[model samples]
Target chain A: MTLFDSLAIAWTALRSNLLRSILTTLGIIIGVASVIILVSVGSGARVEVEKQIASLGSNMLVVFSGSSRGMGGRSAGAGTDLPIAEGDVAAIRDKVQGVIAISGQLNGSGPVVNGNTNWTTTLSGVHPDFATVRDWPVRAGRDFTPQDIRASAKVVILGQTAVKQLFQDEDPIGATIRVKSAPFQVIGVLAPKGQSAMGRDQDDVALIPMTTARGYIVGKSQVQSDQVGQLYIKFDNSTDLKDAQEQIETLLRQRRRIQPGAEDNFNVRNLAETMKARTEVLSTMTYLLAATSVISLIVGGIGIMNIMLVSVTERTREIGLRLAVGARQRDIMRQFLVEAVTLCLIGGLIGIALGVGAAAIVANAADWPVVISPAVIALAMAAAAGTGIVFGYFPARRASGLNPIEALRSE
Target chain B: MNSVAAIIEASQVSAPVAPQSAAPALIRASGVSKIYRMGDQTVRALDDVSLEIAKGDFVAIMGASGSGKSTMMNLIGALDRPTTGHLAIDGRDIATMSSDELADLRNGTIGFVFQQFNLLPRTPALNQVILPLLYAHPRPDDLEARAHHRLEQVGLGKRTDHLPSQLSGGQQQRVAIARALINNPKILLADEPTGALDTKTSEEIMKLFGELNAEGITVIIVTHEPDIADFARRKLVFRDGKIIDDTERAPLKAATAAKDRVL
Candidate 1:
């Protein structure tokens, strides 16, 4: 018989026992739905982490001077490494082939005064390339030119949060604000960036030329090491990040003359790597949930097998009748197998619809992005069919192996 | 012409024996026995039985409960293999044919009707009749027409949409008969076909069988009731796993029997 004909017959049988058929597929429904939800949630988390990390910066590396010890786990204390100077920055910029931009930074924080308002925020002294390296474009006024860095001009760029607190409704560009009684002219307003992974507001900061901060804001140490606290390096793209990071680290080590056996006083951190670690943690959680889903799938298959065995027993006389009418053993076997596959496929389709719907509702509620690709759908379908075959085979074989004489006599 | 001679003269149902030669038997059994192993002991269902049924002949087998009549029917139906002898239907050796071949023999050559009608529950009459044809390869395009024709032959054409639960016992039996005839088998095997029907319905069913037999289909019925067996031209009675009596008589006309029911 044609597969379509067999499927039609199987469908009729299922419809005749509609309630039993539906109950039989409940296990499959729950199994398939849970699997789909787990996969979507995992991918959603990865995407979320990538987004948060991308906001921090893409294809970017932060080079921290001194040992890796801090309140936040990465940033180094100022004046801790005297050997990491502006010359090491120049060497990395010149030697690293994937380098897109690089900047030197010296940092401190203090209260900024404007008219009657005063707000405390981070103050960072950086070269002209700092804003572009961090993907922090200025929103208004004008960028501080290279001449400003060379001449130690007291021009400053205000972050969005700092502007909001210090200026309120007024345009602060070209306005002068005092940092610890030292007057600084606001050259531009930095664009707004949201919170960091650590829940810190990223926009609560100010940027000024490194020369000005070294001389006036955060006065230079007496050793005259020309030391900048950190360096930010941007690569061409994410693909080049690893290679560029390695090149920068090697160039810095060579310029600083650090021995191979000694632990270097600098640490190069890839922002994407840290984000990937968080993604791995999320993926582990997904696997744990997926494992539970798999157990349910097997349990569902067992249910199908149990019900199919019972069906074969219940329809023993029917099997005999078909056999008497010249249906081959294979035909009897195919009939039951088709019934199982039909049940699973229908249940799987419903599960997929339910999973997608649930994922969409949950994602929207939690403010997460969910991707439902065709591949995942196909996998679910294949899994359902496979489950049918694996579980249905035994019962089908039992039915086909029945002696017609004996079967006909079964009540 | 004698009744036997007349039957031999007009036979067109099965086998390819020369007209000038004696007609080869449609069913031939030689010393066929069926033994059942129940636990450690054995029970002989049939023993050393030999018989020949010519094509287009209507025969009735009668016996008590332990007389092996049902066992004989099962063997004739090809539902079981003989223990130590040979049985052949349509000139093919049943002893040597594989299970698949036996199934084909049953499918193409024999039709079976049970006492209970055995119509699938909740299935409409038309689909129940179409079950046999589904297994026929190179499936005929006129399947629905064939099923309808058989239902019409059995006088159930108007109730083709009725389920077994909705039909009377007689109507259900008619439906089963239509299903059996749908494949146009050479022989019809009815086991106590009238056992479950009332007298009037039993007469009606026998009348239908009589009509089919007149159309050149061989008919074999296994019944304990002598009145039901009276409709067949030949009769065999079994006792103690053996045929103890065999007789031939002019069959009772079903029309007269139906008329007698009113009187």
Candidate 2:
């Protein structure tokens, strides 16, 4: 038979029992839809992670004190001997080639009071370049100048949440706020930066010049400074992050006077490591969910096979008539196979629409960043068609191989 | 009267001796046997039986149940291979022909009508008639036109759109006949073609067969009914897997009139 005739025969046979055909394709539909939705969710999570990473400064690296031994030997709290001071930051700026900015931070928590309203928040003492390294934008007033740190001027920058709690509708940039009985003029109010994926509030803090903070708040001299908690380094570009990190690590070890073969005294952290960890966790979760969806698809394929077997039994006489009319065994097989594939393709189409729609709804509800690629759509369609061909083969073969006379004799 | 006797004598002498090999016989069988093995027992359906059918000759085989007349028809129709004999349809030996060649021969030369009518249910008359042509012809347009012409010839022109289920028993049998004739086969085989119809419908079907035979199409009908067998010019009676008697019917002008009226 010609290709058109074969298609006509297959079409007629499928149309003969519309309900059964639809039911047979339900498996492929669910399978295709599940694959699409699961993959979308996975990619959506990856995009979310990248956004959070972008929020933490694009070219910035974080450095904190580590144990004398390797990781897991001791916590940062256990290591009072490893002190990262302002001198190491100056040495790194002078030695490194791609270093753009470097700052040492001392963190302390206390009540920040303005008039009668007081809110507890972290106070970070940083240099003038700290705003440039950490992507901190000043929304109102002005950032601290180098002169403010040199002269130990009593000026502070309030974060968005701190300003909201203390000043309400009023501009708090030029107002005076006391940190533990030391009054300082507000130099600026920083832009809002929302919460991180780890659920830490990013905007509930205050910034002050390192000299002023050390002199008045923490009460330590430059020579006897012992409370430097963290060091923040920024690269000219992300491409230089590794080179800058390696140079700084060497400099800090030499300056701290660690001997050869001694364990490192500090940890180097960058955006790349955080991004990798987040991607790995997200990918594993996506695969697990996708695998569960595939189970339903397999169940759908079984449903198609079972219905096809029933169809073969029901159409025994028709098969006999076709055999009698000089139809080849392969011809019979092809006709049924085409019918099966067509059923699945229809189901696959419906499933694709449902999956995309569901993903869109979820994305809207959770405010997620979702991208539905054309390649994923095509793959889903191909997988659905394969399901039909694989599951529809055995029943078609059985029908084709039936004895003509015996089939005719069957009631 | 003298010529009739002389012709009869000539035929009698020629029957004992096989005819000369120059003329191509439409169907030839020599020592043909069909054995049906049921469990451990073997039934000799046709035991060393031989027969020959010439082109453009209408013949009927009559027998009781289990007489193996249907088995002989199957071998002649190329639907079955003889177990221990040389059986040929037209010039091709059944045993030597491949399955595809047999199918081709069946498509081009042999047409079959069954007692059950065997019309596909829920199918239009035109589609039923066009089915055999689909296997025979390459051009779909020509097949459709030929199918329509055949259905019209069988007096089902207006009923072409009606399904087999909607047609009467006699009409359904006519549709089967139309289907058989669609391929324009050289030989037509009917196995009790009118057995399921009433007396009047049976007569009409027999008359239609007679008309078809008169149109130069070789026709064979298998029937046990004497009245049905009487319509054929030549008849053979089967008994216990063997042809025991072969006879020619008396010349009847009434048969011609009945056939002409049906056509």
Candidate 3:
């Protein structure tokens, strides 16, 4: 028989048992849909994470004080017998290459009073370069200047949430707010940053000059700086982050007189490493989910095999008739094989439609960024087809190996 | 009269019978044997049998149960291979032919009608007839036209679209005959073609077979009933896997006599 005739015959035979054919195809449908949906969800999550990471300012790095001895014995809250003085910032700025900006930060939780309004928020002391390093956007008014830090100026930047809580509908950019026991003018209002995945209130904070924080609140001096919390470093690009981190670690170790092979007390965290760690976690989760989802595909394959075996048995008479009419064994095998593959291909098409629709719906409902890649679509299609061929082989071979006389006699 | 009597006596004494050599022989078997093993015991189905059937001969094989008549039919139809001796169809030794070659020869040379009137259930009469044509010639164009023509020849032109289930037993057998004849085989082999039919239907089927024989197609009928065997011009009876009697009958003077009797 010609290819066309063979296909026509197989099609007719399959259609004769329409319900059975549909049930057999259901396995492939589920398998293909699961594969596509799982991969889509994984890619969706990756895209969302990439977006969040991008929002965190790609060039920024966080450096906390290490437990190394320096000029001052031990700074307050500085655990180390050594202290990371304010002078180290200047030294690093002068020594490090590709260093764009550097800043010192001190965090303290407190309540601020604006007229009749009072809101508790996190207060942070920062140098003039803090805004540049952290990519902090000033929505209104000006950022702190070098002169302000030098003179211990009473000016502060109110985060979006802090401004909203204190001023409500009124503009609080140039308003006065009391911090600790002293009144300070609000120099700027920062933009809203929403909440992080860990449920941290990113916008509930205030930024002030380091000098004013040291003199009025903490009572520390710039030259002898007894307390320092974190140092924020910004590099020109991601490529320079590693080199700068290593150079800074080496400089700090040498300055503190630390020996080789000793664990450094300071933790250097660059956005790239944090991004890598986050991606690793997301990838592991995706892999686990994908592995679990693939179980459905295997089950579906088994279902296909079972149905194909039944089909082979049910069509024994038809197969025998074909064989007796001069049909080659290979021809019978090809006919069954084509039927199986055709079922899977049809199922695969339906599955792709269902999976894409489902993913789109879920992504829209959860407000996630979903990117459906063509490679994933092709992979799922190929996997479904491969499952059909692999699982459909044995039963087809059994059908081909049947004795014509016996099969015809099987009624 | 004396010479004629002497010639007849000498002929009966020397050869018992002399087969006509004018027509070419289509099938020749020499000491063909078919042994079927059942469990540990072996049963001989055809024991060292020799037979010759010439072209355009309508032959009937008659036998009781376990007489190996079916085995002979199978060997002649190329459906089964002989275990020993030479069995030839159209001068080609089938015992030496490969399975594929036998299939090809069967497709080209033989058509079979089974006792059950083996018309595939649910298939249209037209499709049933065209099935054999699918095996003939790699390309099977004009199958519909050929099937229609064959069905018409079998007096089933209007029932071409009707399925086997819709047709009566005699009509179904007619459809099977049409399928057998569609390939224009050299020989038509019918195994109890009217076994399942009523008396009248059986006579009608026999009449159709006689008409086909008249058209010069070598027709072989295997039957246990004397009435069914009477339709053929030549009758061979088998007993214990061997031919016990072979006889020839005079041709019917009028084909309409059988048709009128059926009516």
Tens digits of per-residue lDDT, candidate 1, A1-411, equal 568767988888889889999999989988889889888878877776777887877778888777665544664553477546787778887877877788877778888999888998988888888878888899999887989988989888999999999998999988999986888899899898877777678789888888888787775564244666688888785447777777877877777788997666778888678878988999899889988998888899999999999999999998988887777788888999998899898889988898889889888998667877677778888988989999999999999899987787789
Best by lDDT: 1
In model 1, residue pairs whose N, Cα or C atoms come closer than 3 Å (at least 3 residues apart or on different chains), thus clashing, are: none
Q: Pairs clashing in candidate 2?
A: A27-A300
- Measured by DockQ, the strongest candidate is 1
Minimal lDDT window, size 10, model 2 chain B:
B15-24
Off by over 4 Å in 3: A53-61, A65-86, A96-246, A253-265, A284-295, A346-350, A366-374, B1-20, B96-98, B133-137, B250-263
What are the Cα lDDT values of the candidates? 0.82, 0.78, 0.77
TM-score of each: 0.81, 0.76, 0.73
Q: List fnat per candidate, in order.
A: 0.57, 0.19, 0.15
TM-score of chain B of each: 0.88, 0.87, 0.88
**Which residue segments of model 2 deviate by more than 4 Å?**
A51-60, A65-84, A94-266, B1-24, B250-254, B257-263
At residue A171, give the lDDT of candidate 3: 80
